[model samples]
Target chain A: MNITVLLKQVPDTTAKITISGGKVDENSVSKWSMSPYDEYALESGLQLKEKTGGNLVAITCGPERTKKMLTDAAAVGADTLVHISNDGVTDSTHVQKLLAAAVRRFDSQIVLCGKQAADTNSGSTGPGVAELIDAACVTLVTEVNYSEGKFSTIRPSNSGTEKVAVDGLSVFAFDKGTHELRRPNVRGIMMAKKKQVESITSGDLGVVLDSSNVTLNSQNPPPEKPAGQKFEGAEHVNEVVSKLRNEANVI
Target chain B: MAYEALDFYDVDSLLTEEERMVRDMVRDWVDEEVIPNIEIACREGVFPDEWRVALGEMGVLGAPLKGYDCPGLSYTAYGVICRELERGDSGLRSFASVQGSLAMYPIWDFGSEEQKNHYLPKMASGEWIGCFGLTEPDYGSNPGDMITKAEDMGDHYLLNGAKMWITNGSIAELAVVWAKLDGVIRGFIVEKNDPGFSAPEMKGKHSLKASVTSELVFQDCKIPKDRMLPGVKGLRGPFSCLNNARYGISWGALGSAQACFDSAKDYAMSRIQFDHPIASYQLVQNKLSWMLREITKGQLLAYHLGQKKDSGDWIPEHISLAKMNNVDIALEIARVARDIHGANGILDEYPIMRHMANLESVKTYEGTHDIHNLIIGRHITGIQAFTREA
Candidate 1:
């Protein structure tokens, strides 16, 4: 089986975000890392590939700096790396079409990606690529098992977890699964420095982008939280109760 | 809040992408693994036995050595590993230094191919713990006067000596024992179970509490002829190992200092006094300013030293200077940080006192501050200041 994992590079979760000129100022982001949820997706792919025995490829879309995430993915056991260089932003559908082309080129039997990118939290790429490629799509997957020719998966439903089986090629949008992401050993990091990433433009994948319909008006930082009121001494007990009951709305 | 390393001089720009990756990886690991348990380990006065395997799996045991299942990292990368580990606790960095630069480095540098192939792989994987035995019970600053003797008894060598203040001594599976044979210092690989060999753990320590310090005793210890490290002999063999370890200390001291600075700055910013935060006070700012200034200089010194070492332009004098200067500054920083924490610093809840205590041991070990100064003086004045008339 051929498995492909979709990865995205996002600003490190700890980096302080600042805005300039109606958009997030890229320069203000000091560090970048693999999107958190994508790590779970990659973990699921790696575990499945370990038992099923197949080629594993990690794919990402962005500029040159994003290649670091691909290297990070390779360190943890991605065999082939594909970089779709698209410095310009495209609509979600166009990006999905580009990813679908790469998935088809790799002849992937199963595709795995994060439920949502850490930065945008759009959660659309995995299902969108699946629709474009005409493959079965499963979201919020927590567990997966594979047999001779069938794939068994467990995903959360509106009420509870539901077990589903698929017979054909499929895409899985993973949630936090049973397995935590594995940290790459030093040897893997050293070897990853030598792993080559194949960088190509979206045009190389035979995909064209149309103008996006979405527009951003402005960006602003979240409002500062109000200072917490401190209640001290027994004399203020009734006042605290009144505030909790009336203003805070908690009894 | 996540931990951030001090890089005020844009030192990250000087490093390669791979180097940055190494720093960040080890930094994250230390934050997750070492920081949480360090205080408890210190309070219990024992090194976490489980860390050996974890460290080995991370490939930091013999990180800079090539082949033999080693990670083959650059000198800078190794230095960064030391820095990050020491940021969590100096004892942790001491563990890596002893295992890598002291114990494993000599074997890789001076042992036969068979010895290298046999021990380096196992040591790298943390399957077998190794410790270096050089500083004798009575001879520390002057190891040349060590009384340990290894007499050649035809097919085997009989070794008898005692090494004190040895890190990882009790838990080590193998020890790189240095003893004089025919008045010449030679290195030997002694197994833990060798006849008449013992490593007794030493209890009680106000400093480096999270590490296991012990005394290695060898009484009529018998070892096979082939166990000797044949590639080098004389004081050069052990001095080379010390150089490697001291070089690591230069970088590691900065880590401890940075930890102190980080804590001091954060504490001063939030610790309110009178009406404003303590950070607004001039006295507090003075201490923080001194720490940042000294740390920045020490970082530059360590970075340059690493580059020179990798490029083959460095000498022992450079290492001595760096070790002496960085450790001195680190100890001062710890003191300042402790003062800034006011009584809260003494508690294990804040890392200030632990770091302050650990830095004391660091300043004294790997050739004390005064000894290194003499080494530097000798390099400049063409006279060996460490020697005296007999």
Candidate 2:
């Protein structure tokens, strides 16, 4: 059973968001790091690989800058690295197709990815890839147990948690798990420096490139909240009540 | 949130990705592990014993040494580790420096094959802690004139010496004791439990309080003849080890300065005065700008020196210059930071005072700032100043 983990390199969460020429200026980012949720996914994939004995392949679809993320994944004990070059594609659906192709190319029995990427919080990639590859998909998965060719997944549901046992191929989009990602020690980093990342164009995956249907007119920063008005003394209580009932419309 | 190292001049661009990764990993560990416990440990004046194994598992112990289960990292990476560790606290950085450069380095450079094979792996794994014994009670800067001696018996060597201000001495499993053998300095490995050997922990240290400072005492200690480091003799062996440590201190001081800078900058921005944050004041900006400028210069010095060390182009004078300048600047930055925090800086809640106090020791140790100046002065003028007649 080979496992594939989807990795995304996002700007540091603390980076100040700045818009330039109707798009988010990536150059403004002070650092590039792995998406937070994807860390959980990678941890889950690593655990699964350790238990079931399989090739752990970390796959990412991005431009050259994302190679650092793959190197990082390798440093944390990922056996193989795959980079799908989709430099121009920004569509969630198109990126999912490329990721699915790489997963299939690796002959993966299990696939794992973040519930959503930090840059684009559209929780669609895992399910979209699952649909494309015809594998059972479980979103918001926290843990997965594998035993004797069967896989059982635990995930949060509306009322309680659900433990779904699925046979054959499956995709687990991970939320926060019991285990966080492990830091790569010095020896691991030194060893990871030698691991080569297999870079492939969409052409190699036999996936034709197409323009994204979604067009960004402009990017804008979130509006700052107004300062809170404080009411003092017993005399202003009525005024505060009236404002809450009528002007604020909370009542 | 991800750690943003103070790279005002885009220094990260100059570093390799691996170096940056190493810095981030160590920085993260420090933030998670060391930062939380440092204040309490400093207050208690006790070095945390648990960190040895954790640091070993992280491969930070003897990180630059090759093989023997060591990480064999680049000098730049080793410098990065020191920088990050010192950013948490100077004590942590001192522990690593003494372990890697002072203790393990001498063994790797001068020890016999058997000694290397026996000690390096154990030290690398943190299974056995090691300390360097060179600085004597009477001989601070002048180690070559030390009275400590090791006598050669037919079957074993009799060692008698007392080493002062030894880091990791009390808990170390082995001490790399440098003593005069027939008026020539040689390295010998003294086991902690050896007869007539005892390491007594020195108490009442205000500086480097989070580190274990002890005295290594040897009273006619018996050592196996094979325990001696066979490859090297004379003052050159110890000087080489000092150079390695001095190089690391050059980088480690930058970390202490950076932590103070960060704390001061944040505190200044949030601390309100006269209906505005004190950071809006010109005086505050002046201090902040000065600190940033010095720290940036220190970073460049350490970075270039790390490159030179990696390429085998660096000389002892280069190490002295960096060690002297960086520690001096870091001490200055800590003072400025202490002022920026007003009265709050003195409290343990803020790291400014702690760093300020720690930098004092840093400035004094690894060849005091004045000693480094003399070393560099000799390099430039081709004249020895220490022994010159007034």
Candidate 3:
């Protein structure tokens, strides 16, 4: 059994982002952390490896600075790591192409990626890779069990989640609805000092950048919104529920 | 800015990867499990004993020791754990440090193999609670003049002593008691079940209210002949344990100071006065900047000392120096932080007053602030101050 997980280092969602020359000014970003949804993807990959008895490989696409996420992945039990160093990658389709080429090199039987990279919020990579590679794709998956060339998955549906079983090659992009993110313990961190993250260039992975696929769009900060309604006490429970059900359409 | 709002020096970069991992695990656990419920415990004057087993499961009790089922984290990691635990509440850190450095360190350092086999594993697991009884009712700054005595009998020693200001005293099942035997001081393992041993809770302490304070009483207490620690003699045995506990206090006090400074920074930034935020005032900036500067220095001191401990060349005076300087500075920071919070600080809704109160006890215990000064004072001068008196 083989599992390949995709992770991205993004500016924290709460970081104050600023734009210069139509691109994000890195100075305003307070810190870079692993995309929250990617943690779930890595956790699922680790759990699947635990159950099925195989190796786990974490792969990421970014500059040399992103190597910390690779080492951190190794600290949390990734058997090996691949860093696709390419600073010019921003297109979701290009990410899919580069990832598909790397996944082919590993002959990865199952692929796991975050549903979307938080920085861009363009959630096309997982399905994009599945489309380019011609494999079964499962989106917004929360739980997975793999054995004997098959996968049992749980993903959110209309009203609730549904369990779906599938066989053969597949891709699963995750949400944090289930599976608590496991922090790397001290022993694992000590072990990571001996493990190394292998580097592979995007060019070596046979990623041909199609210039036609690249497009520059307008970039602006999200608009400010009105304050939310606050309801307190047991007496307002019905009113709160009514607002949620009718006004906000949450319930 | 980096989670705690006081680490302007990026102290986390100085820690090893394992140390940082241990710190984050304990810090997150404290934020989620300890902080929300601690104010209630402090206001009601009760120790949150419920977390003891959870702490054991987290592998923190006796975590730095090499064996006896201990976790064996590096000394720096242990210090980070103390820092995070005390950031929640000092009482919790007191319980853990007493269990690890004070109670368990001695048995591992001096006890017989039989004694270690009997108690170390259970104590490490929090299956059994233990307390140290070095600070007696009559001896606070001068433990050498302790009147507690253990007279030798053919079968056992009859012990008579009273240990005050003992943490975890009333609740503990065992105690490592320091008493005189054959006109020389020795360490004895006294079980609470011993016929003449009793521990009663000391009451009405305005400071350290969230921790268990008690008086350890021994009236003709009988112990088996083999229960005495066999590895070392005299004050050397207990003094080593005190050094370890004091090292932890140097780091733990910084946590309290950091928590207070964090609250003060947040309060100053938000509280409106004189038609603008109070943070815009130069005086408020002066206090906040000083606190940040002092907290950074204290953290660096502890980090380097922790490294020295790891390399096994740590001078004993450095422990006293750190305990003296860090606690003194921390108490000052806590006071200023309370003033920054103003009326809101005196209430339990904020931790400034609680930490302010706990630090008062921290300063006096594990060797008082002045006692540490004299310890350092003697180290440089080759003179003993307390012994030369009278």
Instruction: Give Cα-based local distance difference scores for all models.
Output: 0.89, 0.90, 0.86
Worst 10 residues of 2 chain B by lDDT: B1-10
Clashes of each: 0, 0, 1
Q: In model 3, what are the clashing residue pairs, if there are any? A: B1-B5
DockQ of each: 0.59, 0.56, 0.26
Query: What is the alpha-carbon interface RMSD for each candidate?
Result: 1.7, 2.0, 3.9
lDDT of 1 at B151: 98
Which tens-of-lDDT digit does each residue in B30-102 have in candidate 3? 8777889998887787877777876776677876787777778888888888889999888999999899999
* CAPRI-style class, candidate 1: medium
Q: Where in model 1 is the C-alpha error above 4 Å?
A: A158-160, A232-251
| TM-score, first chain, each model | 0.93, 0.92, 0.86
The ten-residue window of minimal lDDT in model 1 chain A covers A86-95
Sort order, TM-score high to low: 1, 2, 3
Reproduced native contacts, each prediction: 0.55, 0.72, 0.24
Question: Estimated TM-score per prediction?
Answer: 0.95, 0.93, 0.87
